[model samples]
Target: MGSTIFTPFSQKELIPKEEKLEIYRRERKLCIGIPKEISIDENRLCLTPDAVQVLVNAGHRVIMERGAGEGSFFTDLQYSEAGAEILENRKDVFAQSLIIKINPPTLEEIEWLQPNAYLISALQINLCSKEYFKKLSDKKINAIAFEYIMDEYKQFSLVRLIGEIAGTISILYASEILAQTNGQMLGGITGVRPTEVVVLGAGIIGEYATKAAIGLGASVKVFDNSIFKLRRLHTIVDNRVPTSIIDPKELKKSLRRADVVIGALPRINQLPIITEDMVSTMKKSSVIIDLTVDSGKCVETSELTTLSNPTVIKNGIVHCGIPNLTSKMSRTTTKAISNFFLSYLLEIDQEGGFENQLVKCQEMKQSLYMYKGRLTKCTIADKFGMQYHDINLLIF
Candidate 1:
């Protein structure tokens, strides 16, 4: 008899059934770290008891560092009732959990992280120290940064919603500053209105600033490099608000007319786009609010401003480049931030677990490090010029 020939089933068909069964057997735990200091803002609450209820119902254990939600007016007792275990020290939370932190983790906090722990936070990895990045790699931890994720629209996914809120609030910030200046009331003035508002970049922040300016009754003109964005803004605002694509000649004219200019430009290679010459063209008493100061100032003459000294006159314009504008409105900022974290948590929970779903999530795909103590994220490997192992091969 001739040797029997047989065909084998493909590996892909046999894989998912085992993977699903494995995921079903594992339990995922999440720990949230929030700051204390409710006296700063009362309207904000991080990881509400309601969100805890959802996690608990999903068969996950939720832990909160003692007073984590105190800054947001959430009590330890409230979280306990919602089925969360409260730990007294922040260190314990990091040691035992998949951590969710609002701010970048401190060096001490980073040291406490368990090996292979998943850390979700607004970690400015590009700006962080090489030592810190090395520690992250050494710990074999997966750091998922909220700022890097893109949404369905392909804009900064996690930040788009929060950016809108921040952008809208930024106008209120400018209004408060405007009220103190010599400018006339935003909307009530008729002849030679008090404020001539110039919004830079025409992104979410610029759009909201335009809306807020219109509501405040200010003469608003928006500027951007993208003619498409400018055209879109003109349509969105029904041409009631004026927008201009930046040209050197037109920029000089616009700056000369602007009394208050909001800089909403995003960061670009740590360089300032609004040159000093452009700044000098503005009115002597004009206010320049640089919202992009977080990435570094957009205005060439701009410097970092704190809540205490939020404005400084430079080259004939008042420059307001405060780093933490959202922090100024902690109540709303905290709630918005908490909601963002909730969305991420729900995504992980719904996908069965972080480890399993991470492969499927485009954002997590970029953020992942080691699966079973092997490197991932090519950027990290390339930056360090180190050898990397494929996570799929290790996991499978």
Candidate 2:
């Protein structure tokens, strides 16, 4: 050993003791709380084997509740082989790590959640009760809602890539309902030569409905409050689809010519856009597909209908307002959802970790609600009558 030790130019620095300790504490693990009580039809598996494989490759541990995938035809052995740990009880999974779920956490399930655990799920929070929010606040749980978050374009963030799939299939769903009705085919030559199709709220669902209608050779007219979105749709469709900025008066006039009306409006806490008078104006033999019926309907005649009994004649117009339209086409919906999950996981993996990557991404940041136990989503806070804190302040 030389007594003359080497002296460095100071390009390399040692990590702080605290920083190294923090790195050691950061582990990759997640728990998936699936409702064993809820029967997963063969069509809808929350996390497919392919998705599990991606997660496994990312070096994250997945803990799943027993029988969680039973409805989806995925046995415990299948998930185990895919590198997921199978836990016997739902509470154990909830208590362990970050949770990813297809449905909203139930009251009982939320009770099992560990404090400060992260959850990724659908926009079922809105459907949750005041009690649920109280529990959420008490537990210091952080959540990312898949539905309300927006991408760069301010569209349905989670549903954007999958919207066309959901939208296109909605037409098939509506068609199935329409087929059961006494009304004639959409593009019949004789009576009602060009079936007058009215698609309200020219968003993704409306655009796809327009496409489906056009494909079926039916005349399509799209109504929207946003002239901007309507114009965008016009450009995308090459002006082939006619769009109208909805005037309440004009809406009445248009309904008279409509053979099939599709409501694709976003949720608003107000009276239905289509009043009984508007429904009365529609042709007696016409059909109404209320896509927005999930968040309270746009059509006055619309009522909640299940896939089992999907249609009812209200005010002499056939109405269909099934909540889970995509579920009707489960194969495509599940595959699309699986692809999204894979893409989301890969995006996180590429950036090192979900917290570091997601919190830094501006689009994801906008969707973030709480960071390090501080309120970050102002809109949600305002909606829920809670105090808002700037995300930057919370993170720092």
Candidate 3:
């Protein structure tokens, strides 16, 4: 029979067999926005003038609102010289293709953003409300929380840098506070014994706090719930500082003798490690700098305060719980943030912009809470009782 006598599946050879490849997207020229921080305490700028110069040199336009860098002491002239366009109206900055900020945008600022604008900023979840997430989602913004963004090492790079600054600043701040409160020095003298510093938690903040305190010639001890963290810290500090697994009794005992307490623990909704009673047990006129207060109060007595009115006296102990405490050195923090951000934004550009970045970079998805009006972060979804969408499913 002539069945199957057809010539090699009929016109199969006529069909073009060239292997199809993905359409290569050229690098994007992202327009970056830098708005003036609305809140006074949010003194850090996302990009320094040098970063602006880098982005501009890479064929991108930078738009900064007038006085955006005043807090960081980076003048508009500097940005202008760096090839940034200074806009008189702040809303104009938010209208750009990309927005990089130290603080999350205010509701008004969010509304000002063009739909689908890429936002890179701190989430500061504790400070956000359900409505805040809703506003971002409603805007259909592509937002990434810089706080949760991880580096190649799977570490929160931005948070660690800021934490490092916060830790060192915590000790320095305590020194000034101690002198004012009781005329006591922070470090040891030749004859006098070394001043005591009690550091809570053993994360990046706690570790840096320990190092700074030790450097200042203070007798130091660290306490944390995790034995692993404590042990790691012990090794990191060369055992110069004693480490404990947060024995309540021992903590209370140490607090009594502690001249400075640096609360570096990452506490959220959970009850603080140091209760009010524990704080009360500390010596009078002792200084407590709660570095983690932005997330939650590490010391029960510590209340979130502004930079202008930073310290509060309660139980005869001076407490400072200023969020963005590292912003006290606005210039330094700005520079560090700028360095991190310069690389991050350029990577996004090299990847062909944010959407392509989402498709390719898993680490970027880790920090994304919202994508095109969908809730992508489980933590934010759970907190707000909103529907959670896995970013992976939505993107790919």
TM-score of each: 0.80, 0.83, 0.94
Of the two candidates 1 and 3, the one with more favorable lDDT, higher being better, is 3
TM-score of model 2 relative to the true fold?
0.83
| Clashing residue pairs in candidate 2 (N, C-alpha, C atoms within 3 angstroms) | 40-71
Write down the lDDT that model 3 would get.
Answer: 0.87
User: Which digits, one per residue and each the tens of the lDDT, describe model 2 over residues 1-396?
Assistant: 769756664435543444433332233544444434342232354577667877887777778777766655667888789988887877788886577776667777778988988777665333456566666667888777777566557666466644676667666665665666654676646555777788897778788878887887778888998999898888877547877887899889889998788888855455788899888877775788887775657887788776667788877888887656666665556666777767776666566555775556766766666554556666556667777878665553
Per-residue lDDT of model 3, residues 239-272, tens digit only: 5578888889999999999999998886777788
Instruction: Compute the lDDT of residue 395 as modeled in candidate 1.
Output: 46
RMSD of each: 5.7, 5.5, 2.7
Model 1: how far residue 220 lies from native, Å: 1.5
How accurate locally is residue 28 in candidate 1, as Cα lDDT from 0 to 100? 50
Clashing pairs in 3: none
Please name the candidate that would achieve the greatest lDDT relative to the true structure: 3
| Predicted structure 1, TM vs. truth | 0.80
Indicate the residue-level lDDT of 149 in model 2.
62
lDDT of 1 by residue, 1-396 (tens): 799656596668656563333334334555544433222223344467777777777667777777777655677888889988887776677776577665566666778888878776665444455566667777877777666656445567556666777677777877777668764455536655447788888887788788888877778888898988888788888556777777678877888888777888865445677789888877776678887775646788877777678889887577887655666776567767767667777777677677666556565665555443455656556655666777555543
Q: TM-score of predicted model 3?
A: 0.94
Q: lDDT for every model?
A: 0.69, 0.70, 0.87
The clash count of every prediction, one per candidate, is 3, 1, 0
Residue 241 in model 2: shift from native, Å? 1.5
